[model samples]
Target: MSAVVRGLVARGAGQELTVEDVRLPRPDAGEVRVRIRAAGVCHSDLSMVNGTLAPPFPLVLGHEAAGVVVEVGDGVERVRVEDHVVLNWAPACRQCWFCRHDEPWLCASSGTPAVARGATADGAQLHVTLGLGALAQEVVVPQHAVIAVPPALPWAEAALLGCAVLTGVGAVNNTAAVKAGDSVAVIGLGGVGLAALTAARAAGAGPVIAVDVSPAKRELALAAGATDYLVSDDRLAKTIRELTEGRGVDHAFECVGRSATIRTAWRSARRGGQVIVVGMGAKDDEVGLSALDIFHSARTLRSSVYGSSDPDREVPELARAVLDGSLSLAPLITDRIPLDAAPAAFERMARGEGARSVVLFDE
Candidate 1:
């Protein structure tokens, strides 16, 4: 009831990810096995490999993925075998405090993953990332972590829906709630930042401004619905204000996850506007809050995780958006490399050289 699959495992900090033959675990009680089709190369996965988010070594390092259900364990009813699903890292324990409070994405019992080794292989235990290390050809995830979607949905696009798209679009639609005709600014033109741009446009945000250092990515930002693109420069805020009739954008999204970019997000928004932080930076890194700015600027700053979305509800909805052409995922998929090219793909992401390079396993 298992398969020997190729997976990327990073043994320790500053170590390269090794492609190893690993054992896939069988579904435990209330769990399901997924035949992974596509896995997006997220920045978090890069962070793990580069020692940004320090976790235990010798661990599998992927979470954003979409696959088909291959089998179901006893007492599992979330989805039937053969259904397509997107892997959800924030698996909600419905009875938990955050889940009970209508915030399933922040489910109190949802963060960590338990290594489920049906039988030991190489005398080492197998651990899943966020309960769904889906980088390999197959993955075993808890029933709650798989949100069933239409089989008609392509795996590559659905894979991104698992994280980046959800986080970006959800930030605008759910967290900041940018209204129609509202001017918005997005700091950082990575996957999530571009996603935020298009999502704001879909919601009727006027004059969506995208900021990034890479001119290449700035062009990509325009294609993804950014009305204006700004390269790194002085008077960035002044330029944004000039575009918005001397008042800054109503909402600003910080997708770079840096203290400096966060400050940009705060300053980019107009007085009484909102700033939503969507980046996942170092936990110890702090964003300075000035006493005068808070009182005089009339601005609101907030951090949003996973776009504040209900996975079960929003995953399928976002997929539908892609299916119906409301959400454009084609441009985001800038590169597709086979499983063997994963290392280089990671390198490309580390350098911020590509939009998205998904590892296609289906072949």
Candidate 2:
């Protein structure tokens, strides 16, 4: 049987989202139905609305989310009904080539069910973004698409573990593996960059520098453990070098996902340092680097997809950090609105208003 639910749906490319009636079906084999409690409004969601991503039309756009399992389908044993879970947009298929090589984060089959599952009141099929359309009040996803989280974790905070926290902290801990005393610089102080800042501080990295174009985010960055802050400008690389005593940071993270910021991250790292790209840029956008520049600079440029994380393992560790007070998820949430206000939340994100704007379904 299918149930009628209200959800935000994009009718066409570059169209505003409308809350409409959606028909959700019961979970099938190896799937589970989740009652979404909180969903983070991300830049990626905004990109989808503006056609930065070529997702099918009439799509439900959301990925960073947390919820409770209401029911499970046949063969679903990893999670039971009433279990709290964080939705994983990139669920690894263990049989994939990358999974076989122990790189499940790069799983070739991460994006599955390319077709949408639900339909509108008028009977038009609706595509669920990232195979886990969580913007709806409830969602049906594969068992592997949801990871059990600590019961004590708040839904608003737990929601971030799905995307921002996973990517940001994972970049520092798993992707770059920043060692103690290593100098780090993060470009673009959004939710992801701030998470990187917090993780660097927790890892005992020294002289953590934060770069951003917005002056409003400086205070938040500092509070999140940034040792130094700089406004994004032509002198960003030079400023970072000066802060690290003229050698540039040992590791530089680009979270802005733009060609210019990526170049900045490259220039902000030490000659032989690591430049980790954590942002998801558009396919048409390209970054150019001279042959000599690439050869002369002995730095390693790597892309950190989902923070090179295995959700089952890392989400629990991150939840523990929140419980122990070593990691602060509270400061990362700047705005909390109801589900109806989600479109406005995206507007705030476009204007660089805050770190994260989470839609509270419990409100």
Candidate 3:
């Protein structure tokens, strides 16, 4: 048995996505077939399309999604049919070197072809993005890739938990270990930036500053609990320092995934402060710093992959925060459209139009 479903497929680098009929096979052993209810359009997906992060072509390009498990293959014990789950793109293999060493987010086998199991209508093997493609109405992923969430959780908001929320909040809570009264600045006001803002506020960080080039995102940032907002410009670092009493923020987050924004994040941090890189940038893009400056800065630079999250443990906690009103997933979702409208959504994202645009599927 097979399912023919419409999905956004990227046929080649720098090409626009085409909605095509994808033929998905039934769940193989250790796999689960999910009926995607909602999927978030992320910059990472755009990177795959634009050739920044090269995945195999003819790929289904989406990873942030939530859905219901409609069927499970033999030996699947993590979840049962009808279980609501947040699709985790990086499903760690516990026996892998990274996982055994407590760095499961960097699991060696998470996003390889060895884990993908699907095909296209023409019988060509389909390469799923991050090994958990959610652009389609249905997906068959490894059992570990689906983390069960409460059924009461709304599919649209829960969809973001897999990517933006985990990366944003996890960066603060797990990676940076932000403490109360620490000054924080987030350079970018997208879903990930807002999630950082919300987590910073929850952590009692002082003067959580949000920076972005777009003036329209000020309100969204403020509503997400940023104490201050600044537009990205030549004097951004000076303005941030002035706001922090001639000292830059204690912690700065780079969420835009560009060399320029990354420089801004590094320059906006106080001496000895931590600059956390949360965005996924192009492999070729590089940020240059003088040797003397690096020596004198006395700052720590680190990258936060998937928010340094262990999905099995963090996704549920994040969901609980949303359920308890401690976290605001509502502000992050700026637009909701059907799957066919994903191209327009991508255009909006490219224009920095809104925070997140989710593709909703019929119940």
Candidate 4:
């Protein structure tokens, strides 16, 4: 059995995304079909069209989403119909060496830019981003790709847990291991960066500094619990140091994913501080560091892939936090739009106009 649904499709790089009829096949064994409730318009989704990531053409372009399982294939016992779930882009294969070593985020079987799935209305073969193209009315994905969450979780905020919240919060708690009173600087004020700022405040970090190129983000930064907001400029590192009592912050997070911003993050940290790279960038773009600086600074530089998180274990915990009112997602969502308005949301994202523009599907 199969169904035709409206989905956002990108024909190629530098082209506008279009809403078109997509033919979706029924779930195979160990798979489930979800009725997408809300999907976040993420930077990584923009990467698919901006040439930062070279995915195949005629692709569906979303991975950060939440929905209700409406159909389950044979052998799919992890989730059932009517269960609310968050999508996991990088589902770990537990048998991999990295998974056995307690690093499922580094699971060997993940990381494909796109996977061949259903087709367009005209019968042309189509591909879905990260193996779960979710910016659509519905999606059929492997059962492992969906983690069941509380039914009461709001759809818009639940969508963020799959990407922005998970990646941003995980980078702070797991990758950087930020403790209370640890001074922190987060460079970039996008959804992930803002999430990092919120997580820092929740962890009891002091003087959480939020840096971005846009002066318009100051209010958003403050609301996200940033004690200070600085517009990125040539003297950004020096300005950050001045605010941190001339020693820089204990942790510097680079969420912009460019080499230039990575360098700024490195310079914004104290000599022995940790620098966590949370952004996904092109493979060709390289960061250059002097051998002398490396030896003298004694800093630890690492990349936090998918926030170094295990979604299966963490998404439910995050849901509990939301239910208990300990964590608030209100600051992260700037706009709630219908699916047809997704292209405009992408334009706003490119212009650095908002934090997150979520596409809401009708119930």
Best by TM-score: 4
Measured by lDDT, the strongest candidate is: 4
Residue-wise C-alpha lDDT for candidate 2, range 1-363, written one tens digit per residue? 987877878887667778888898899999999999999988877878775777777888788999999999999999999999999999999998899998999999885523488898999987888888788899999999999998999898899999999999999999999989999999887788889999999899999998888988889999989998888888899989988888989999999888999999999999999999998888888999888988998999989989999988999999988888888987688988887888888878888778998888862
Question: lDDT by residue for model 3 over 1-363, one digit each (tens)?
Answer: 988888988788878788899888888999899999999999888888776776786899899999999999999999999999999989898998999999999999875632345677788788788887798899998899999999889998899999999999999998999999999999988889999999999999999999998999999999988999899999999999999998899999999898988888889999899999999899889998778878999989899999999999999998888888778788899999998899889888888889999999997
All candidates' lDDT scores? Answer: 0.83, 0.88, 0.90, 0.94
Q: How far off is residue 346 in model 4, in Å?
A: 0.9
TM-score of each: 0.95, 0.97, 0.97, 0.99
Query: Candidate 4 lDDT, tens digit per residue, 30-102?
Result: 9999999999999999999998988998999899999999999999999999999999999999999999999
* lDDT of candidate 1 over 15-64, digit per residue (tens): 87777778876778998888889998888777766655777656776899
Prediction 4 global C-alpha lDDT: 0.94
Native-referenced Cα lDDT, model 3: 0.90
What's model 2's lDDT at 218?
Answer: 88
Cα error, candidate 2, residue 227 (Å)? 0.8
Error (Å) of candidate 2 at residue 120 is: 1.3
Each model's RMSD to truth, in Å?
Answer: 1.7, 1.3, 1.3, 0.7
Winner on lDDT (1 vs 2): 2
lDDT of 2 at 182: 100
Residue range with the least summed lDDT across 10 consecutive positions in model 3: 111-120
lDDT of model 4 at residue 245? 89
